[model samples]
Target: MLHPALLDRLCKTYDGRKILDDISVSLAPGSINALLGPNGAGKTTLIGCLLGLLVPDSGAVRIWGENADKLSPETRCRIGFVPQTMTGLTWFRVQELKDYLSAFRNQPDGAEDRRWADWAALDPKARISTLSGGERQRLAIVLALRFSPDLIILDEPVASLDPMARHDFIALLSETVQRRETTALISSHIISDLERICDRFLVMKKGRLIGDLSAEVFAGEIRRLAIWPDTALGLEVLADLPDGSVWVRGWRPELDARNLPVLAGDMEAYFLALTR
Candidate 1:
């Protein structure tokens, strides 16, 4: 069967600079994939291309075995998205907006997953303008998750939420993914927020994907070796290791060389290896 989402040799450029360079990947069904990169690394551009908001110069983005740019309205509604930031629509009351969204969500032949307002705990009469940043984010999340979309794209979803709210959001996200077998792609700089939930990672650099691997494989490949050299070799002790390993500062030259890789270290270290 064809993949649910595919970006095949996608390329996009703006002005004189390239925004995406030969991007190609297929997102697995029911998988939580994290997309990571530094600023200006073309993450947003790639997402735009996927959503058919921006056309790639060459190649294609396919959703449900059909071209994304020309997806039928019914197919399009099956996808959900939460952008990095939202604005305007501040005049609508919380329940007013939910009612408006619900009208569009329940098409004649569409799947129904309703009552997301309750999932988000948004006050019915609250004005969008009066809601806090976290509350706004919560509302956005509910809108995206309400349909139990076949595929969900979240860009920096937890950046504005508090610690407890972040946890709760992840729990909600996980529950949705598990219950409905949803495919989710989340782009975020908050590694800690994504590390536990993501089953796969996509690392980008200079408008190109540098690493794409399952979370388990990534953990095995990028290891933190704590070294203690008996002799004064300085940094030369790690001169023969692979390229991705980082030189942690716990090394002691005079003491015994304790060269052991820590289990389940921070995902940030792996990201650093890809970017640097």
Candidate 2:
């Protein structure tokens, strides 16, 4: 089966520094994937390569089985992207911008765009310059989903949103993806938000793909165990375990395994454990 997106041994370098090391991954159709990494981990660079915005020094990028670099206009229209920053069109009204983008597509659904704008609580008549950061982010999302693309890539999409707005955005995203069976790759620093919707996690560190696990496996396998001095299992014993568990900071001798306290081992914890 063809993947919605695939990167094979992708490598990219800039100014004599590697921005993306040898990386390989494929996005499953209709899957909502969370791309997690710290700053300079090359999440944005990978996205750029996948979208054909940046040429990888080596390897290949394929979208729906077609070479990403040579995607036909029809294939390109099947993809939607919400960038971290929305710039250079601040003078246009929201509706005007929508119309401009719609002009490029073979089919433009103005009603669908308006529906998304309403869901985002955006005023169509409002100028882009007048929108707040969160509002601009909302507009970006609306524009990206307006055409019902098969794949959507979002970068720090909810960075400027409030907690409630973030929740709503996640819900909207989840619904849209499920309804359209659209594949989504979301890169964000907000782990909890991603945990709420993403079924798969792709962890990167220092420009390398360090981990890839389904949410279930991540929660079950990657965990923090509070070991106490009283327990027969010492740090050395844990070190000898077959699973290759490494000891992280904050060792408390007072807590024991009998009353073992297990941290939720959510995405944030797993991300920190992998990166740090």
Best by TM-score: 2
lDDT of 1 at 28: 91
Span of 10 residues, lowest total lDDT, candidate 1: 232-241
Provide the overall lDDT of each model, using Cα atoms, as 2-decimal numbers.
Answer: 0.78, 0.83
Q: Highest lDDT among the candidates is held by which one?
A: 2
Clashing pairs in model 2? none
Per-residue lDDT tens digits for candidate 2, residues 1-276, read 889999999999999998899999999999999999999999999999999998999999999989888999999999999999888899999989988988998564666665677778888899999999989988898889899899999999989888888888898889888887899999999999899889899999888998888877655444465442234544322211224444333334554344655544456866776787
Native-referenced Cα lDDT, model 2: 0.83
**Candidates' RMSD to native:** 5.9, 5.2
As a TM-score, model 2 comes out at 0.86
Q: Provide the lDDT at 97 for model 1.
A: 84
Candidate 1 per-residue lDDT over residues 189-268, each given as its tens digit: 98987888899989888889977878776554444444433344343232122543443333344423454554344777
| lDDT of residue 145 for candidate 1 | 75
